[model samples]
Target chain A: MAQIRMETNLLGANDMLAAKNRRIFKARGLLVINLMSSPGSGKTTLLEKTIEALRGRIELGVIEGDLYTDQDAMRIENKGVEVVQINTEGTCHLDAGMIEKAWSRLEHLPIQLLFIENVGNLVCPAEFDLGEDIRVVVLSTTEGHDKVLKYPLVFQQAQVVVLNKIDLLPYTDFDLNAFNRDLQLVNPQIRVFQLSGRTGEGLAQWTEWLVEEVGKRVI
Target chain B: MHEMSLIAEMMNMVRESAAHNNITRISRIKLVVGKLTMAMPHSLRFAFHTMARDGLFQGTELLIEEREVAYQCCQCGEKYLPDMPYGQLCPNCGSKASHLLSGRELFVEYYEGDSGKGEENGANTHGN
Candidate 1:
C-alpha cells in the first residue's frame, strides 16, 4: 500500500490569489462589490439602473461573468460605461483568477466603484472570495422566500441582500415579512433592501447605501 | 462543484512539497476548516478521494480538524461560541456588536509520515 502524508487546504490556492487581488484593490482605493444571485434575478437590470443613477457621481466599471454569451457585457457597454465580459466557459462560478484576468483589461479606466456580476448560481459563488469590499446577494420575489433558508451560506456570507423585482409583488405570493425573518435567522447583521429595477421603485435606498459604502472607501 | 477545483489545488500542493523533499510516499494529511466557510467535509472527502487516485496522495488518510466560530462582544467583552446552524444573538452580553475572532480559516497545520530516509521513523514536519 502506498502511503502519503500532507497538510494543505483545498482552498489554499484560491485564497492566495484572492489575497493578491485584495491588495491591488486596496492600493487603488476602489470599492469592489461581488454581486451574486440565481438566474433571472435582475442582477443586470439592477446594474443598469444603478449606473444610470450614479453615472456622474461615481466613476463606475463592471466585470460581467456568465457561463456563455457577452450579452450582459454588451448591455453594460451600451450604457457608456467601462465593462469586461468573462465567459466561465461552462463553469458555474467566477474565481479570483478570473477577476484578476478581467482587471488587467479594465484596470486602466478611472473607476472608483467596481461591480463584479457573478454567474447566477447561489451555491458555488458563495464559496470563492473575489476580493471585494462587499458580497451582495440578489433575491427576486418571483424566486420565492425559501431561498434564504435553503442557501444559508450565501446569506451568512453576504453583507447586504437586495430583494429585486418588488414591482411584481402584487402578482406573486411573496411574503416579505417571512423572508426577512428567515434572512435575519441566517444573518442578523445583513442589510436588506427591497426594490424593483424595472419601475425604479425602491432603487433610491439601494443607491443611497451604495453611495455611502463607496464614500467610506474613497481617499 | 467548486470542491473539485479545490481538491485539485490541494493535490498539487502535496505533490510539489513531496517532490521538493524527495519523499515518495505519504501516510496522512491534516487540514483545518472553519465553520464560517462554506466547505463541506463530506463533499471535500468524496472529491479528494476521486482526485487523489494515481497521485502522490493515493492512499493517504484525510484528516479534518474543525474550528468553531468564536465571537467577542465589542461592548461587554464577552466571548462565546454560537450555536450550530449559526446566527444567534450573543448569549452573554446580548449584543450584536460582536467581532469574529476565528472560523474563517482554511489551512493545513502539519503532516505525519515518512522522512525520506531509508529508516521508516523520522520527525514530522509542519507547514503554514
Candidate 2:
C-alpha cells in the first residue's frame, strides 16, 4: 500500500463504543460497575454474596465474562437476578463492543444496577474500560501482598478494592498492612473493603455501599 | 496471548489507510509500543507473521520501538523514570506520582511500501 501517515489508537473503536454504552446506561439511569481480577480471585463468590444481601434492596443484572464456561452466569441467575453470559472463548479480556452487544440483549429487562464481571485477567481487562461508572477489583488474601505492586494498573484504576478471602488469612502469609500501604501509594483515593465471601464477613458493608451507589444514580 | 487480536485490528486499520492512499503493497511497518503495556515483542512478531503472511501485505517487515517508562511526579513537580516497572513512588521526593507522560502507547507510527501511481497501476516511487 501507499506509505500513508496514520495515527490510530489500537483501542479507538472499543473506546468509542464504550462511550456509547455509557450513554445508554446513563440515559436509562442504570449505575454500572465493572468487576475485574485474576482468575479465581473470588469475584463471583463476592457477587453471589452481594446478590444475596441486596436482592430486594435494588434491581440488578449481571453480565458475566468467562473464557469458556457459563458457570458464573448460572450463579447469578440462581440468585434471582437477570444474568447474561459472554463466553470470550480464548480472549483474555472483555472490550466495550462485547459489552454493548450484551447490553442490547438485556435492554428489555429491568436492571437498575449492572455488574459487569469482566474476563478474569488483571492486565488486559484494566487496559480497557467498559463504560463503567466505577471499576472495582477483587484481590484475595491468598494472592499475597506482592500482587498489588506487580499488577499496579488494575489496582490503581480501581474505585473500590475488595480484598476477599480474608477468612483464610491465618493460613497464608498475606500481609494486609503492606497491601494497604502499597494500595495507598498506588491510589490514595481508593475505597478498600476487606471481606470474606465464604464466611459472610463484611458483606453488609458492600451491600450498603452498593445500595448507596445505585441510589446516587437515581438522583 | 491477545496479541493476535491486536494484530488483526491493527491490520484492518492499515488496510483502510492503504486503500485511501492507493498503496499497492506494504513492505515495512513501524510501531511504537509502551513498556508499561508489558506486551512481549516476540509474541507480537509471531502474531504478525502468522496472520499477515496471507492477508493484505505478505512478508512485511515489522519494526517495533518501545518507549521508555516516564511519568511526572505529582507531589514534587519532578518527572523521572522509575527503576522498576509499575512503580508508584517517586524516587525524587518519595511522593506518589499521578500523570503518566509516556510508556502506555500502542499505535502504528507509519508504513513504507510501493503505492499505485494515481493514474492507475503503473509506476512505483521510492517510499520511505
Candidate 3:
C-alpha cells in the first residue's frame, strides 16, 4: 500500500477564478459589490432605492442571480441600468464561475459600480467568493434580530450589513441592541446602515458610502 | 446542502491525484474541515457515500478532522482558541481588535491507496 500525501484546498478552483476576476475588476477600476440576503430580505428593493439615490452621480450595472426567474434583473433594468441575469437552476449559491460568465455579458457597458445580487441564501452564499470589492448582507427588520447569531458565518464574512425595512421597525419585534451586540461579536469591522427601501429613509448615508467606495477604487 | 458540491470538488481533485500516482483502488481518504467552515461532517459523509460509489472508490474509508476556531488579538498580539463561534473579542484585553487564526479551513489532507496488486488485508495498521 502506498501512502500518498496531497494537501489541496477544496475551493481551490473557485478561489483561483475569483482571483482572476479580482484582477480584471482592478484593471477596469470597477467597484463590485456582492449583495446577499435571505429570501424575503428585500435585496431587490434596496437595489432600486440605491440606484434611485445614486442615479446621476454614478454609472451602475447589476448581475442578478436567482433560481429561475429574471424578475429582479428586470427591475434593475427598468432603473435604466445595464443588467444581466444568471439562472443557477436549483443551486443555492452563485459561485465565482457564474460571476465570470455574467460579467462577460455585461463588461461592455460603461459602468463604475457593479452589483452582483446573489441568490437568497444566508448559509450557502457565504462560502462562495465572487471577487467583489465589498460584500453586503441585507437583513430586514422583519427577519428577526437572531439572524446575526443564527447565521454567523454570513454576517462574519460580510463587510457591510444593510438593515432594511426600518420603516416597519416599530411593527416588528427586532431588537436593535441585541443585533448590534451580536454583530460586534461576529465581525467587529463591519459597517452597518439602517434604511427603508419603501419610504426612502436613511438611503443617503448608504448611497454616499457607495459613491465614496467607487471613488476610492478608481485607478 | 452545499456539502454535496464540496465533496464533488474533492472527488475531482482525488481523481486527478489518483491518475497521477497510478492508484487504482483507494482504501482511505482523510479530510480536514474547520468548524467555522459550516460544512457539516455528517453531511459530507453522506455526500461521499452517495457520490463515491464507483469501483475505484469502493469501500473507501472517509476520515474527517475538525479544527476548532482560533483567533489572534491584533492589539495584544495573543493567539487563543475561542469557546464559541461568536468569540471574536480578545479574552485577555477585552478588545474587539482581533482576527481569525484558524477555523475557515476546508481541505483534502491525503489518501492511502493501492496499485491493485492484491494488497488487501496486508497489515490493518492504518485502522483508526
Q: Each model's TM-score?
A: 0.83, 0.93, 0.93
- Which whole-number lDDT from 0 to 100 does residue B119 have in model 3? 58
Q: What is candidate 2's CAPRI-style docking category based on DockQ?
A: acceptable
lDDT by residue (tens digit), candidate 1, A1-219 = 223344456676777899999999988989999999999999999999999999789999999999899999999999999999999887778999999999999888889999999999898898899888899999999999988877777898899999999999988989989898777766888998989999999999999988998888877
Cα lDDT tens digits, model 3, A163-207, are 999999999999999999989888888999999999999999999
Interface RMSD of 3: 5.3
Each prediction's whole-model lDDT (CA): 0.83, 0.83, 0.89
When summed lDDT is taken over every stretch of 10 residues in candidate 2 chain A, the lowest stretch is A1-10
Q: Which clashing pairs does model 2 show?
A: A1-B23, A1-B25, A1-B26, A2-B23
Q: Can you tell me which runs of candidate 1 are displaced by over 4 Å?
A: A1-9, B34-36, B53-55, B64-84, B91-105, B109-123
- Every candidate's DockQ is 0.28, 0.43, 0.46
Candidate 1 has an lDDT of 0.83
Where's the lowest-lDDT run of ten residues in candidate 1 chain A? A1-10
A205, model 2: CA deviation in Å?
1.1
Model 1 C-alpha lDDT per residue in residues B1-128, reported as the tens digit of each score: 66666666776777677676666666777778787676678877998898777745768887888898787777888787876355545787676666778776677655445544665544654333
The DockQ-based CAPRI class assigned to model 1 is acceptable
True contacts kept of each: 0.30, 0.43, 0.59
